[model samples]
Target: MESGNTITIACAASKRTSLHGLDNIAAEGSEGYDNLINLVEDLHSMNVINSEESKELTNSIISKLKEEFNKDLDDSIIKIENWGAHIVRTINQDSWRLERLGSLLQGQGIIIMDWAMKFLPQRFREKQTD
Candidate 1:
């Protein structure tokens, strides 16, 4: 499969995995915010939604959860860096895929790397270079 298709498939698979977690988390009262964040991050990483869409969805969910629990919940914005980290984590988890993707990108590796590096956590970036 082409690299772009591979990425899409990987991202879709990741989303499916996360959605299962989300289903479980959603059952708990007021304790699922973190999982919600992960869902949003995964959605954004998958390109299934844009930043604005993520933000809107987050706010909507938070509102619903608050109404259900009749308690205040912290509003969250879509963290692009977290999304970046999620993508990196996904890639790192499969070394063979990373190699294939790198080869697929070819001359564009530097540009993609530069963009990804900017948003990755400092600790992750440090570990990568070590």
Candidate 2:
């Protein structure tokens, strides 16, 4: 398989494994992974961006959640950098496939915007108070 396909398959497998783990955690009465699971589910629900692109996004989100969980500043910054570059490369491919990809990404974009609306202002306010 292509490297991209490998990453996609790996991501899907990892997501499944993590979610199953989260289910066990939930059964044990902890809700630590709920937000992460919700984010992954959102990515899974999207039909745009093929398996590879979806995996890229899913990995990015998982990395973000990892940063939140572990407070790994350096790794999280690297993930953010790579995520932006990957997105730019995808948008710049200038192909019919990407045009279709954009349509699917539009939905995900809206979700991001909603999150930004909720998250950014609260963060800004907290900074202001400090």
Candidate 3:
């Protein structure tokens, strides 16, 4: 939750769209939520990040469905300013964890490329290939 906490897109949200499963749920309240949860949880439990389904999901399925839903369903990525560089406020000397988001902070030259939002995992492979 930083300056723009718009990254959070939950199905139950009114103004925001859920990041996972793309189901039309405007008035179907309970049922819609249920379906969304099931879809999300099922996908989360899967090792499908690099699987074909995931690529198809982002490139075709989700892209097409997005245009179809329009508004009723809030499953779209909102328009907001995302700083090219993440914010790293502090550093954990004891833990290997990155305290915030501005590089290695310690200047250890550790590059943690986060492609989690990217539709293709091949992007990561290509980066490493370079």
- Name the best candidate (by lDDT): 1
CA lDDT of 3 in candidate 3? 26
Over the full model, what C-alpha lDDT does candidate 2 score relative to the true structure? 0.54
Off by over 4 Å in 3: 1-13, 17-45, 48-50, 69-130
Off by over 4 Å in 2: 1-46, 72-130
CA lDDT of every candidate: 0.59, 0.54, 0.44
* Candidate 3: residue 36 lDDT (0-100): 53
Encode model 1's per-residue lDDT on 1-130: one tens digit a residue: 1346665344433322344335433334334554686789899999999999999988988788668544322222235567788889877856765676768654564224444555565746565444
What's the TM-score of every candidate structure?
0.30, 0.23, 0.23
TM-score of 2: 0.23
lDDT of 3: 0.44
Off by over 4 Å in 1: 1-27, 71-130
Per-residue lDDT of candidate 2, residues 16-95 (tens digit): 33543344432322123444545555766785345676567668766766665566457667889999997887576546
